[model samples]
Target chain A: MNDFIRNLASDLLRLEINTIIKQNMSAEKIPSNKRVLLRKLADMYRETLIDYGIAKSADDPQLTAADAPKVLRWQFGGEFSFKEIALMASKGIEQLEQAIKNETDPLRLNVLNSRQKILQRICNQSYNVIGIFKLFRRDLAPDTLMQSNEHEEPAKQIHYVDKEHFNYLRYQRGELPLECIPFRSHQETAHWNNDLDWMHLNAADDLPFLPDMLAMIYKAYQIGTEQIVLQTVIQVEGDITSYITPQYINMPDNIKEVVMNVHNRAISLSTQFWNTLFSTVMNLAGKSFNQIFTRNRK
Target chain B: MTLHSIALLWKKTVNWTFVPVKGLQFARSLLKNGGHVVETSFVFGKASFTFKTVISFGDIVVFIPDPAGYYAQHQWHDLCQNPHWHACYQKYLQIHFEEIANYFHAIERQIAFWQNSISGFIGIVNIYPLYRALLLGEWFLLFFPIASALYIRFLGKVTARAIALQLWQIAKKWFIPKAALIAKILPKAG
Candidate 1:
C-alpha cells in the first residue's frame, strides 16, 4: 500500500512538472537569460527534492556559472546563445534525454519524476515573484506599522452537527498518524520558499509573484481534489462498510467553491492548455480506477 | 472527511505554526510566509505574540486571530511588569476594574488555501489552561474526533479495566464480601 501511494506520488509529480513545462512553453519561447534562469530553477528543484528524500540520486552533475550548457559548448563550437539553441530543441527534450540515458530502476525513475515536479513548483514560484513585482510594484516598500494588535476573529459556527456529536481533537491527544494530513501542504511550502529565493535573486518584493503563484496553487488544488476522489474510490473498493467510507465524506459547499475557483484560474492560464491538462488528469484518474477494479476481480 | 476531522486538522495546523515565537521572530516568520501579526497589549504583565493573529498583555486583550492577516490594534498596554493592585485601580482604562486588560490586533497574511474543505470561518474559542487539571477525564474525552461515538467505546474499555481491578482496590477500600462481588459483576456487564 505504501509503495502504491509512493508510486502515485511520483506519477503525480511528473504530471505536475509536465503541466508547468507545457504552460511555460506555450506562454512564450525561452529567451537567452530566461533559459539560463530556467536551468538554474531546474537545478534548484533537483537539489531540493534530493534533500527532502523525495528524490534519491547521489550524483547528477552540478550546475555552475562557467559550466552552463552554452558557455561550455560555445568555446568549442558556434556563437549561438544557450537559450536560442534550447529554444530550437524540442519541448521536454532535456528531461526526456536524461530519462533515456538513466537506468530504469523504479527508485531512479521516482527521483527524476519527483525532480520534474519540483521544477514545476520552482517555475510557479518564479512566476509568482515576477507577477507580484509587476502588479504591486508600488506597495513593495515595507509599511510603517510592522506589527499591530488586531487579531483574527473566531471562525463563524456552522451548524452541521451538534457540538456534542462532532467533537474536535488536538494533535497531542490523537493516536492518528501524521500522514492523515494531505502531502499537498508540504509541496505548497516548498513552492513558496522557492519563490522567496527568486525574489531574493531579483531584489524584489515577493508580492509581485502573486498571479502565477495563484495559478500553481490552482493546479495543486485540482490535483488535491482528484486525489481525495481517488482515495475515496480505493477505500470504497476495499469494503463498502469501512468507517472512512466514501459515503461518509460529506464535502461542504464552500469547498466546492474553492474547487471552482481553482478551475476558473486554471482556465485563465490558457483555456486550451487548461482543457487539455484537465482532460488528461481525468483520463488518468479513470485509468487508475479501472486498474483497481480489474485487480479486484482478478 | 467528517466535520470533526476537518476542525481537528485545522486547529492542529494553526497551533503547529503559531504557538512558538515572540517580537521580531514571530513577525518575520508570519510576514516572510505571507502572514501578519496582531499586537495585543495588556493592562499589566509581560507582552507576548502567538501565531499569525494573537497578542497578549494583561487580562484585557483584543479579539481572536482571523485567517487573513489584517492586523488591527485594539487597546494600549499598561507597562507595569509587576502586579500592583494600586496601579490597575489608579489608571482608569475601563469603567469597571477587571483584573486584566487584553487588546486584540489583526494582521493580514496571505495563505493560498488549496483545499475545498477549508472554509474562511475558523472557530476561535477561549481555552483555560486551569481546567486541564481537574477535568482529566473530560479533557481526555474531549480530544477524540466524533467524541459522542467514541465516548461509548472508551466507557466500555474503562469498565473492562475496572472489572479486572475489582479485587485490586479491595485492600485499600475494605469493602464487604457481597459488595465486592457486585462491583466485579457490574463492570463486566458494562
Candidate 2:
C-alpha cells in the first residue's frame, strides 16, 4: 500500500510537470529547443531547491541540534552538491543572457529576462545555503570540545537564538544576507511596490483570472459569514426546541400553551422558508437540465 | 493457535483496516492544508454568469456576474479608453504579480495532489475487494469488483458543487464590491 501511494504521488507529479510545460509553451510560444532547455533547467532547480528539503529546513526555526548535523551532511554530500547546483544555475543564466542578447522580439526578450531573473535567484539561494549551514554549525558546536583541546582555551557557550534575534544580530553587524533581505523587504513593502518589468512580459496573461478570483474569495468570506449566521439561527432554534421539550412536561398548562404556540410559530416560519428554498432549487435544477437537453438536441 | 498464526492474523487485520484509514487521514490532511487553493480554482471555473444567475434567482438574487471574464474584459476596455486608469491598473498588476504567480503555482500543486490522491484512494479501495474475493474463493463477489465506484464518483461531484455554490455566495457578497471599488477609485485614463 505504501508503495502504491508513492507510485501514485510520483505519477501525479509527472503529470503536473507536463501540464506546466504545456501551459508555458502555449503562453510563451518559445522555440522547441529553448523550451526543452528551460524545462530541464526548471526540473533541475525544483529538485535542488524544493525536492532536497534542505533549503526549507534551513529556513525552519525549530531545527534541533541532532537534525543540524544530518542536514549539513546532506547539503555537502547530497546527490548534487550546492556548488554544483550553483554552477548549473550560472550556466543557465549565461544561456538565458545569450538568448536575450540575440532575440529581436521584445516579448521573447521579456520572457528570457524573467527566466534569467529566476535562475539568478536560484543561484543566490544556493550560495546562501552554504552560509546558513555554516551558521548552523557554529551554533551547534560543543563548548566541551574546545576545553578538551590542549592548545585552545574554553570558548564562551553561545546559545542558539531564534530567527528574530538572528536577524537582529545580522542587522546590528550591518550584514544583510540575500535570504534575510528578500523576506524583510517583502514584509516592509507588501502593500506598495511598483515594479512594472513584468507588465511588458505579459505575465498577467498567464493567469488572467487572478484579480477576479481574489475578489471572489473576498466575496466568499462575506457570504460564508452570512451563511454561518443563518446556520446559527437554525441551530439556536433547534436548541430551544430541545431545551423546551423536557421543561414542557413540568410546566403549568397556561405556560405550556404559550410555549407550544411560540415554538409552533417559529417552526412554521423556518419550515416555510426552507420549503420555499428547496422548491426554488429544484426548479432551477430542472430548468438547467431542460436547457442542456434542448441545446444538445439543437 | 500458534504465535506465528496470531501474528499473521494481526498483520492481515491491520492491512485490511488500518491502511485505508491511514490513507484517508493522509488525504484529509492534504485537503486541509491545500484545499483553499483548489477551492479557488473551482470557483473560477464554475462561477460563470449562468451559474451566478441560477444561484441568485434561487436566493435573494444578489446578481453578481462572473468576475473571471468580466474583470479581464473590463480591464482591457478601461486600459484602452483611459490612460490614467491604465497606468494604475498596470501598477496594480505589477505590484501583485508575484503574489498572483505564487497563487497560480500553489493552485497547480494542490490540483495535482488532489487528483493523484483521489485516484489512488479509489484504485486501492477497488483493488481490496477483489483481493478479498479471490482469497476467500467468493466467486459471486468477483462480479461486483467496482461496486462502490459510481457511488464515490457521485459523492465527489455533489461535494464539489456544494462547495462551489457556497464560495460563489461569498464572492458575490464581498469580492465583487471590492473589485468595483478598486475600479472606481483608480484614476480614469483621461
Candidate 3:
C-alpha cells in the first residue's frame, strides 16, 4: 500500500516538474539552451512511455525537427497548450507557496487546499488513462514477473473465441502463426505492472500518431490474422468448422461493430483473395466427391 | 446404349456382389477407382428389392436402375404426377432436410474433436515450456497449414456423405415408390 502511494506521488511530482519547466521556459522567462534541454527531457519521457505500451491512442513516432513548431498539451481534448498549462500550473503552485508564506490566515489555508484540489482534478482529467499493463510472453520466461489484481472487469472483453475464428481463417489460408501482443490486463494470473513507465504511456494526453498508427496496425491484418488464427487453433477446441466457417458470426452489437471496423479495413487487401481461395478449395472438394460417384458405375 | 439396356447391364453387373451389413449402419458404399457403387435395400411383399447403385459422380447420373422395376421404374414420374403422392413426396424431401441438419451437427462433432486434440497438445506444451521450445521450433509453422488442409480434406469426407445422401434421396424416388417407394425403404418394420 505504501509503495503504491509513494509511487503515485512520485509520478505526479514528475509530471508537475515537467509541466512547470515547460511553462517557465516559454510563457515565462528561461534561457534558450535550458529550454532545449527541458524539451529533450520531455521528449525522452514520452518516448519511454511509448516503449512501455502505455502511450495514448493518438501517439505516433515523432516527426523530424523540420515539422512545424513544437506543441504539447495535457490531454488530447484539452484546449490549452503546454505553455498555457504551464502558466496555469505556475499560478496554482505559487498560490500554495504564497499561502505557506503567510502561514497564519485560515482563509489563505482554505485557498491553498482548494487550489491543490483543483490541480489534482486537472491532472486526473488530463492524464488519467490508468491502471495495469498486462504482459503474456509466449516464451513464458521466468523473468517476466507480474503482480495479480483480482478486481475490475473491463466493460468490453476480447474473447478467445473471436481470436479462434480469426486464427482459424488464417490457418486455412496457409498462413503463419501470430505474434503475441501485450495487453492491459490478464484476469487469470491477475499479474500486472503499473510502474511509472507504464503509467506515463497510459496517461499520454495527446496522441498525434492516431491515424498513421492505426493504418500501420491495419496493414498487419494479413500477417497478424495468420498468427491470430494459428494461436486460436492452438488454444481452442470444438466446432472446428464454425471456428473459421466462412459464414458471418453473430456477435453482440458492440463487439460486432469493432469486428466490422477491423474487417472493413482489411477487406481491400484480403477479402477477395480469401473468398477465391475458399471457393477453390470447396470446388475441388466437390469435384473429388463427384468423381468418386461417377467413375465407379461403369 | 439406350437407358433400358444400360439399366439391364447395371442390374446384372451388381447381382453377384454382397457385402456384410455390419458396422455400416449409417451407410454402405463401395468406393471404387474412377467412381463408386452404393448399396441400397428394401422389402416389398416378402420379396426384398436390393440393388447396387453404380454412381458416376462426374456424370451426376446416380444409377441406371431396372426400368421395369414396378414400384420405381416408370412409377416415379407417375408418382410425381400423382396428387396423393404430393404429401408423401414432400414428406420424403423433409427427411432429406433433416439429414442435412444432422450432417451439420456431425460436423460440429468433428470440430470439437479437433479442438480438444489441439488444446490438449497445447496445454502440455504450455505447462512444460521446454516442450514448446522444441515443438514450436522454426519448421513448426509448416505444420499449421498441413493440419488445416488435412482437416479440410477430412471435412471433405464428411461432406461427401451429405452430398451422397442428397443424391441417394433423389435416386430413391425411382426405387422407392412415392406410395410404394417411400413405403419400401427406411423400413418401418421387419
Candidate 4:
C-alpha cells in the first residue's frame, strides 16, 4: 500500500510539475524543448497521482481495519459508531500499506494488489451492502423470502462471490444475476398490447431496434448487457405469434458482444419513449383546455 | 476535544472563509490522526495534506455526508452538469436528444453503476484484482461523459416533448377548419 502511495505521489508530483510547465509554455514565450520535456513528465505524473492518493489513504491505520462488516454495522442502523470503524479501517489499511512497502518480491506485489481489490470491494459494498444489512435488521418470519420469486427460502447468508463466478453464472443462463429472475410474465393481469409493442418496434422503421431496445432495457433494469439474451425475436399479429430463441442463433465468437448491442438499443429506446412523454404531456393537456375555452367563445 | 467537536472544527476549518493557515493546519492534523482528509472543496486555494499513518490508498477517505463545499462550488458543478457549455468546443454530444431520453439515460447509468458495484462488493468477482479493476474503471469513465449525457438527455426529452405537443396542437387546430371550432381547440398562444 505504501509503495503504491509513494509511487502514486511521485507520479502526481511529476504531473504537477508538467502542468506548471505546460501552463507557462502555453501562456509565455518559452523554449520548445523544455516545454516538451515538461509535458511528457507531467503526463507521467498525472497518471500516478490517483494511485498516490490511494496509497496515502491506505497508509491510514484505521482505514484497512474498518472493512465491510464495520462499515455495514455503522451504516445499517448506527449500531457501530463510525469513529471507531473509521479508526479500525484506517489502521488496517496502514498495516497493509506497510506490508507492501516492506515486501521486495514481485510476487508479493501481486498479493498486495489482490488485497487492494478486496478493500475496494468493501468500500463499494459500503453503499448497497448497507442496504442489505438493513434488510437483515427488518423483523420478519425467518423462512419468509423478501423477494420470493428469486429465492425459495429466506437467504441463509449474504455470501460474497468472485467476479468470475458472477460472470459464469450470468453467462450460463443469460439471465439477471441472483438466485431467481424478478419479472413474472404479467400477461393475465396486464393487457397484452401486441400491436403497441409491434408499433414501438416499427417506430424504428427497420432501423436496428434490437440494439437500442436492448440498451434501454439494460439501463432501465440496471443489469449487464450480457444478462439479457435476445432469446427470440417474436413477431406477433392478431392471435398468431412467432419468435426465434437463442438456441437458433449460432456464432463462433462470444455472445456478450451481441448482447451489448441489444443493451445499447434497449437503453436508447427506453429513454426515447419516456422523453417523448415528458416533453409533450403538459402541452397536450393545455391544448385540450384551449379547445373547451374556444368552444365557449363560439 | 470530543470527536464530534473535532469533526465540527474540521468542517469549519475546511471552508475558504477560514484563513489558509487554518486550512493547512487542519489538513495536517487530520492526517496525523490517521484520518483521510479529502480536499474536494477548493473554493479558496490549493487543498492538500500529508499522511502521518500508514493506510491503504482506498482506506483513508473521510466520507462526510453532504459536504458543504460541494454546495459552495455549485456554479462550477453546474457547468460540469451541462457539459455542452464546454464540451461543444471539445466536440461532444449536445442539444440533439428528446428530454425523456436524456433523463432515462442518467437514471440508467446510476442504476448500472450500482448493480456492478454491488456485485463487485459481494465478491461477485471473488475480490480478484483484474475483475475489480475492470469494474472500477468502467464506473470511473461514466463520471464524465455519461453524467453530461444524462443532463443533455433530460433537456432533449423535455424540448422534444414540447415540440411534439406543439405539433399536436397545430394539427388539432387545422382538423376543424371552422374558425369557431379551431378557436375552441387551440388555446390562445400566450
For residues A190-237, could you state the per-residue lDDT of candidate 2 as single tens digits? 111111122222221221111122222222221321101011123212
**Between prediction 2 and prediction 3, which has the larger TM-score?**
2
Off by over 4 Å in 2: A1-44, A47-80, A141-298, B1-42, B46-190
**Which runs of model 4 end up more than 4 angstroms from their true locations?**
A1-72, A75-253, A279-283, A292-298, B1-190
* lDDT (Cα) of model 1: 0.29
Q: Rank the candidates by lDDT, best first.
A: 2, 3, 4, 1
Error of 4 at B78 (Å): 48
lDDT of 3 by residue, A148-256 (tens): 2222133332232124334334434644222111122222322222111223434433222221222222222111111111001111122122122111232234323
Over 4 Å off, model 3: A1-298, B1-68, B71-77, B119-190
Write down the RMSD of candidate 3 (Cα, Å): 32.5
- Stretch of 10 with least lDDT, candidate 1 chain A: A16-25
Q: Candidate 2: what lDDT?
A: 0.35
Ranking by TM-score: 1, 2, 4, 3
lDDT of 1 by residue, A58-110 (tens): 22233222222221111000011112222322223355446747758766665
Backbone clash total, candidate 4: 80
For all predicted structures, in order, the TM-scores are 0.20, 0.20, 0.16, 0.17
